[model samples]
Target: MPIKLHDFQQEVVNKFFKSGSLLCVLPTGTGKTVVALEIIRRLKEQYGNKTKCLIVVPANLRSNFVDTIRKFQLKLNAEIIQKVSQLDQAYRTKTILVISYDFMRLYALKLLRYKWTLIVADEVHYAKNRQTKNFAVLYQLRLNSRHFLGLTASPIANTPEEFFTILIIVTGDRSIFAEGMQLIKYMEIGRKDPTWWEKLKATLTGRRPRSKKGELIPIGIKDIEAFRRLVGRWVYIPHYSKIEKLGTRPKVKSFVVRVDLDDFETKAYKYALRKIPRQDLKDLKEGTITNARLRQIKNIIMACQQTLLSPDYIYEYEERGQEGVEQSNISLFRPGSKIKAVAKFLKQTGEKTIVFSSFLRFGARLANHYFNKLGIKSREYSGAVKPQERKEIIKQFEEGDLQVICLTGAGQEGMNLPSCKNVFFLNLPWHGEILRQVVGRALRITSKNPFVRMFWLFAYTKDGQETIDLWLSNLIKRKDIIRNAIFAALQETTANVSVQLPSYEGPRPKSKRKPDTVLGINYPR
Candidate 1:
């Protein structure tokens, strides 16, 4: 059977009915592609049979779309392929061609030759940056071109001006939401209307026709009209609750594992810390430091952190803009107590686990050594891994073929590994966005009772204490420090943007800390 449009999708298609361009904001895994497919069908029939469509998505998602097309049996009526090169080679006319944003950037002039009847950009948030090459290429290709569409789960911007730019591109009207309808306000509107809320639920989900077409719940026309007026005919469906349909999440317990740094590690960390300019550190807190200096400080901190884990990671960047060579091959090797600690924990539990490091070389080294010596199957994933192979490795890990999967930043976002109930953090990222994404990977929802055991291996400062143990706590502190420092440094009249960090509440075990810190978060089962 051909993929039929759900009521939510149908409503969107009806809104864009004869319109040439649209910006749809639906959640991920919600079949935005189906909406795109429906729009394509409607355009071909109403606009003209000769009208063609182009789709741009992240490189990793290209194959997923190809699979989605075949799985939905869209081949009968839709002209969809995996990549642009395939279509370019054929020189055959296909109504729809799917390509990556990278491809679009590299071959912008060549692709601009085609008068695209419609262009759909999936994960449209990539275009939020007006200065990006992707943004530049997309703008050129869609110049004066009608029938362009953009899609994203979240359309967020740090500043109002940035948000306005997105609004103009999406609505094609500078006056859109001119009454100061903030994007945050639009996100909150769904909770106030039940009918719209239902459509939102349907839009975020990818479930099949659980209810018959006649029995399907319908959203109110008046509500839709009101939303249209507010956000300008653009579909802005934000999840009222991120995991509402996931039922219940497993218990998340956080326990800190403090390891004493050896003599070599202590000397290395102290040396690095001493070399860092105290004024730069002060500037970081005062928000007076340049971005370059802030990054340099961050790199120093990260290197010291790595040294605590494995002293072999310490590298001195020469003034020549390259790393200094070591005296001997053995000089680069060290007794990695941190790696030993992780392996000990894994050996004791002997269950499915995910080990995360911030660097690919370290993660790969750890994974390779563990598997080689212990004869335990494992794999490492990072930007270095082939896109196709990453999927296969994740599949194998999920299927229990691999006992563990060591990963860098790649594991942080939107990858499902619910089967692994245990997570070991070998290194922590300073960015809250990254830290949250990593911890979230091991989280899985199930009807039955499920528990997640999270372990954080951290080293102490000169005073022998970890300033921040919890990622959320550290994030909150970091925000306060930076905002205050920036405000103080600039002494500008501009108001500070309020911070809104996600907070989840659930049952909590008794804590010896302060009462407020006991807010039932990170379910400890």
Candidate 2:
């Protein structure tokens, strides 16, 4: 059967075909690749087989793209090339070239020798960083390619400056920055007083402020009235109530073990904090100093002290052990007291569970502990796992051979794991997107489950809560924006339709200069 395109996918293709370059934003699992493939198909049909297309993606995802293309059986010939030298041979054929972002810098000059008809940038937000070598290469490619397209799910930036840079890359217009600034100014003014635009236009142009009688004049008010009717209105209502029928909920019991810092661990943490910033140390370095400079001194002192003291001073000594003591004490695999609690819960509940950790070592340790000590079935997938092995682990998880799936963020992306409804965050991911992906494993649309429970194991401290809050805020904002946009579109469809006729009936003339005003404008700072 031929591949089918969703309404959103079709819309994306239509927009791209109409415009030379576009930034296509859609949520994950929305089949962005289908939209991209449709564009490729249409371009090939229109321009013939000689046309070339280049797809840039993250290094880890290169295999995933290749698999997708093959599974779909797209007619377009595609090659996955990582080296610059390979491009010379690959460019001879009318084929789509998929490459990693890292390889772009190494082979940019070589690849630029050939002329590409179209270039598609996947995860295009990364190309906005002007300082990166890959970004520069991509920027030059944008100017050289006949057509350009950018695809991303998360396009919102923390600041307007970053957003503008992305827009410029997608649209190839420096003026987009100025337009964005103008829109921001208007939005700020409108927030303070909704009628600020009328006042500003009147003040700046020395025109009479329109009264209720003048409102019917239809020059300025016509457009405003039309827009108001088109966009409709949105309002929020707050409600508070006490629950009469309280429900019992399953509780995720957790235990925190206070592992006293040994002499070596204390010194290592101090050294790690001093040598590098405290923020740089990940969970893996919790009780160990991995810094090269401090390791030798730390090892020598630890070997001399036969019985290391807790919170003891670590000074210089002779006759230290060859191996570092810090490495020994930092047990990434230690079951701790929490292991028994987790194992007992699993056996009693008989519910499939997912355990996540920031450090792969910790995940491995937990998986091993459950398997060896508790005789529970478990499997681990992380960056260290070979591609083939990772696939096999996923297969096992889906087949019910594994009761617990222990993994890091690397395994979370593009993988479907719906057997489990209970998810445990052994450690939190820094990015909100990663967290979403991890939890998404339990949220398969086809599953019969009524609800899924996600357990976040955060330390009972201000810093941990702050991090969780930041991630929560970002998630809420993203959800709200998408919800509002969809609601607005639905409202527009339900409202009365109005059409305006052009003043002139002759064929529309093309202008040499750019349009005076775009839909959204921002004044430059």
Candidate 3:
């Protein structure tokens, strides 16, 4: 049986072959991996034994690529290089080598000795920070490979800097955008009005610097029209909405479940906030906290956020029990309202659900509550578990052995969870793109559900006092506004039919709402 690709995916493959390097921005669950695999098959057929590919993914996602290969019956020789010792044999024989970002960083120099015909960075945005070893190694790898592919659903998460870093790695041109703000000047909206750029910067950063004289008037849309025109040559975005072959993805109904904190929670949250130095809070308001002070402020904010989740987390319980498993006797501490709300909702829904939480301990507590308290089969999926155990946990969830899987940030990206159609967020992620990635795990093309349900748990005090939940949610909303405007520019770009290969020259680079019903559940006031 031959592998068939959607028309848009075929277009992505065409772009990659013509340009030799591409930043593929396909929406999640739309088969980005299939496209990459198709490319590899062609490479193998064209180049044969000479075809060597390097796939860099987050540690947890390495297995996903390997599994897809087997599932599709693509008898490709793929190897997972765990330690430096195994690299020599794999480098010599394995046509496809899947290495995690962390392992690649650790053994970059040694791995660099081998030549790769193609390199694919899965979830490449992990290298957004130029200072980290992630970016450094990826840049070197891209330079070594004859063809490079950067795969990510959301290219510009929060700021242009992320896209800029990826641009540098893909093109090896560091001077194109100098800084992220330079990329913004090319936007048509800002080019027509320089003040628009400044306002945008201020709004995105929550800091307003005095407008300076002699600002660079954007050369013109011809110089580079926003992000799309600038990186137009090297980037190909096949959005899910535009894919006719997909017919229509399962509709996702999102709701914000407001959980009211009980008296104990309210008092604990207020006390934690009050314990923070008044001066630090003032600095936060003024947006003048030093980097050191910023860390302290984050710690305080984290403490208060934990206060809403569980008292066990607030007390700093070990993420895993003494037996090296995530199971914990959460009964020791009174479960918080948020936990009760999540458990109750899962009980009522009685479906496979993935509950995402930032805190590892909170994830453990939720899993414990589901099984021990509610008699619902559950397990904790986090980095704390061994790779094999994580695989088994996912299997159990898929096979109906587990009713719910409490996942941490580790499993947010690249993990396919089409088995589950319900996603619950214990709290909001720092970036909007992460929120999308987590939701994408359940929105698979193979899903049987007619629609997916996503719920975000937000805690508030009855007295109308603003909690950190409200603050974070509002912040994400504002960031989403900026993210939407930037990516929306890509929609305006006219696709080029002529296949002109790109040179390593320079850089470049919202929703209506129906009132969702609040979960009508009673909590002790």
Candidate 4:
């Protein structure tokens, strides 16, 4: 049976087949899996039973992919390959084999020996870091495969440089841009007053770059439009609004809610900051901190953040000797203002909500508070929860048995919670991409709620002095500027270019739109 596809997805699939390698970016809940499956089905039909496909996904997402295939009722021979020993047998028999990134990294060389007709990397941004072993493994596999596909909702999560590896993998051109110094030079090709060199020198010598006006100008993307044009050729990004059949996605209302810490908590925060070494503080003030000094400074900052959240996290960290700073002598079990604020917000909304925390102890403490204090049915979802238990928790949350769930970073990647519309961040991650992925758990296209409300909870001082939360928020805003600029380019490219389909041996379905020019390449229209 032929699988049904939305018009935009069909168009995207057509583009992938024509180009042989491409990156497909679709907003969460917009059915990226369906597009991949449709491409797989076509490859099977075109190449016969001998066609081989490898789908690499994050560990937590493996089940989601399998469940999607089952829901679609697709008869494609897909199997989850868990062991390196099973790889050989599965490679011979299965038409499509899905493996996790962790497993792939472990058996990279073994898997590289085999040829795959198509390689689909879901959440492909995981390989964006060139320093990661997964990137090296995926790079080789991309070279070995006949066709490569990278899928992600947020490609440039942190910076534009993250896209460099993904581009090289798809385009298979290591020298496409050039090496480090030359690459930086290329990025500054059109700049009138190039500052990359000065920035690099300052960075190496523990100094800051300043403009002619003596204002700090952080080194960042100089020409986002040029980068967009470069990356636009290999990417196909479609929004739900553009694809009418996908239905209207609810508009998201995001808020940054500031909570004031109580008197004692404020005192504890100040005490924690005082515990940092005077030399370290001076280094930070002078912007001359080494790697070790920077790490210690980060630890102190985290201790201060934990101070804002709860005393329980601080005690736990102190016990583990994780927080080098001294813990304030206060009641460790008492819930602080942030925790109380979260409880109040949850009780007031009375909607299914998910609280995200980067720290495990904080999430557990919050979940415990909800269950014991507020009487709201809640549980913790993190790496500590067994896979089977995680499934049960998700079932409970979806079926209304649970009202709140505290999710840690471990559960962020592959967990889908469309039933949840309210997301509260007890803590902020350093990267904007991570924040997006966590929020994506609820902002699915299939969500029942019309609007997904996201609250970023922050703690501030009475004097309005900026804290880690505010600093992190500002960082995310800067990162978003890069993402929005590149996405704008991709959106324009998608609108202007038309994919030229190959001639079919038999009949073809009719369409109202005609083939248009793409990247100066002429084909049958």
lDDT of each: 0.54, 0.49, 0.68, 0.67
Each model's Cα RMSD: 13.0, 18.2, 8.5, 13.0
Provide the lowest-lDDT 10-residue window in model 3: 498-507
TM agreement with the true structure for every prediction: 0.66, 0.59, 0.81, 0.80
Cα lDDT tens digits for candidate 3, 174-195: 8644633545532222122434
Model 3 clash pairs?
none
Best by TM-score: 3
Q: After superposition, how far is residue 416 of candidate 1 from its true place, in Å?
A: 4.5
Encode model 1's per-residue lDDT on 177-225: one tens digit a residue. 3432322121111112324322433222211123211111211122323
Clashes of each: 2, 9, 0, 0
Alpha-carbon runs more than 4 Å astray in model 2: 157-162, 181-345, 349-353, 362-372, 418-420, 441-452, 459-525
In order of TM-score, best first, we have 3, 4, 1, 2
Q: Which residue pairs show backbone clashes in model 2?
A: 179-521, 179-522, 180-522, 181-522, 181-523, 182-522, 182-523, 183-521, 183-522
Worst 10 residues of 1 by lDDT: 183-192
Superposed on all Cα atoms, model 2 deviates from the true structure by an RMSD in Å of: 18.2
lDDT of 4 by residue, 1-525 (tens): 556877777878988988888898776667788899889888988999889999999887787767878898887888898988898899889999999999999989899899999999998988988899978899899989999999987777655557667778877778543331122211111122334334442222112233332222223334555555566567888743464344544446566566677667776676776877876554433333333345557867677667777755554565667543233332345766766777776666667888888876644545455555667778888888888999899999998678888888887777778888777788777667667677778766577777677777667665554455665565455446446645555653332111111121211244676643222211123
lDDT of 1 at 395: 88
